[model samples]
Target chain A: MHPRLTLALTLIEAVAILAYAISGFIEARKRRLDAVGTFLVGFATAFGGGTVRDVLLEHRPFYWVEHQTYVIVLFVASLFAPFVLRTLSRLFSERALLVADAIGLGLFSISGTSIALEAGMPAFTATLMGVATGVFGGLIRDVLCNVVPLILRDSRPYATCAFAGCWLYLLLDHFDVDSVYSLIIATAFILIARLVTFKLNVRLPH
Target chain B: MHPRLTLALTLIEAVAILAYAISGFIEARKRRLDAVGTFLVGFATAFGGGTVRDVLLEHRPFYWVEHQTYVIVLFVASLFAPFVLRTLSRLFSERALLVADAIGLGLFSISGTSIALEAGMPAFTATLMGVATGVFGGLIRDVLCNVVPLILRDSRPYATCAFAGCWLYLLLDHFDVDSVYSLIIATAFILIARLVTFKLNVRLPH
Candidate 1:
């Protein structure tokens, strides 16, 4: 991979991790889970998808396991989540959740696709894995909360954006595009598509 | 992996997979899911735990993927599930569910531990993975059905049985017991314990 693309992915990963952890924290609080449950849910939300992808691709020691600092960061963040949530509740709104989810989806989807491609998966499987990596964390969290998975039931174009973005990335890569450009363009497309879907109330038939 | 032990595991695995799939089919029908959803949930319940285990241990070409017959069997069974379920509604009762669940828990718990040991995991991690493999299929199914996991909140000796059984297997192995005997004793213990717990109305205080 290009050095610049690696750097870009690293940066996107950081943001995605934080966004997903916060999303988990919020869901944990809503479910009235204790601190331990909060941390477990937050940790799962941050790392579950990539872990599954890595496992599927026969990548050992998982991404988080390889990056100890990520685990520590999530642990410390989870320790402070309840206090931080209390302070943010007055200012936080659904918009924050929406934005965070969109950004995380885009970044994780691109990263997941890149990993699958590197692992020599076919385009369809790679794209499917990308969408799965973007969505399964929330699926796990909702399962923990005993709710029908939002991606499965909701009409919104959640996994669809990830799927489309992955195809764009695959298409660009097929045409000899630079890795860095492909990553950026695909991520941006997913982000914009997600937000646009929300703005336009775009939905699949339920 | 002795030949006898391998044969035992293969037979046990077949039973566990079938039992878990049936459990999933019942849950999907109860929820009124369509055929696709029924198959998805059934597949997940049958394979989800072992998939997670193999991925964690860096085992490539998952068991079901390696043995395509299992997938075919699950697919065919799923196609017939709604019909079979309606006909068996009178024949299938809670007792069958409990018995199937107990047998699955016992067999999967031992198999998971064996795999983890073969993968060179520490005893504690191996034991934990064993219990996880035993219970996670049910966890996935319940999550899909929008219910709190039985292991997490039912106050029953669900995961407790698996955990205890894994430890027994670990201890027997530690004592240099024959592999076949250790597997048999441990699995029997879990099955009996689970059934006894239900029969006696034994539950942990919530």
Candidate 2:
């Protein structure tokens, strides 16, 4: 891996984790779960998809297990979430949660697709895995919270955004596009698509 | 694996999957999910735990993916679930579902523990993985149906039953008990524990 590209990927992962954790925190608060429940949901939202992906691919040393420091950081942050959330309730609005989740979705889609490609999986399977790696975390989170999963019920283009972005990444890679360029374009596409869909209230038929 | 042991394990696997799928079908009917939804929930309940176990153990080709025949079998069965459930509803009462689930829980607990041991995981980790393999499918089923997971909420000996059985299996193995004998003893322990708990209406305080 190019040093510069590795650095970029790492940055995206960090940001995505933070974004997803915040969204999970907000959802946990809405349900009035205790500290343990809040932390569990947040952890699941941030890492469940990748964990599943690694498992399916037979990868060892799961991301969270490999980076124990990240788990420690998340734990410390979760401990203070309730107090921080109470103070910043206005700024951390429902829209904010959607935006954070969208950002995570975009970053994860690119990362997952790239990893699957590197693993030498077939294109269709790689794309499906990429979408699964992007959306399964949120799916797990919603299920843990005992709600109809948003991806299943909401007409908004959630998994669709990830699917589109992943396919774009795969297509660009096939066309001999530079890795960094493809990553940026794919990620931005998903983020923007999600935001626009939300703003315009665009929905698929129920 | 010994030929007899392997045969026994395969039979248990078949029975456990069927039992869990039936439980899942009942839950889907209770929620009035359509055919697609019914199949999705049933698949999750039947396969979710083993999927998690295989992933954590870095096993490849996921059990269902490897055995596409099982997927087809389950799909065909799920298609007829609503009709069969309607006719069998009175005979296959809620109590029957519990019993069936308990049987699955016991079988999965032993299978997971044995597999983990074969994979050379530490004893404690193997034990925990065993319990996870026993209970996670049902947990996924409950979550998808927008209910608090039974293992997490139900006061009865749910996960506890699996945990106890797994430990029993591990201890018997340590004592050089015959593999077949140990598996049967452990599985029976879990099945009996769960049935007795339900019969006595035993529950842990919330």
lDDT of 1: 0.82
Of the candidates shown, which would achieve the greatest TM-score relative to the real structure?
Answer: 1
**Can you write out model 1's per-residue Cα lDDT over B1-206, one digit (the tens) per residue?**
78987887787778778889888888877776655456658878988888878878887667765676776677667667767677656777868767867889998899899999999999999999998888888888887989877679888898899899999999999899988789889999999999999899998988
Question: Model 1, A30: alpha-carbon shift in Å?
Answer: 1.5
What is candidate 1's TM-score for chain A? 0.91
Q: Can you list the residue pairs that collide in candidate 1?
A: none
TM-score of chain B of each: 0.91, 0.89
Model 1's CAPRI class? Answer: incorrect
Residue B203, model 1, lDDT: 82
Native contacts kept, each candidate:
0.24, 0.24
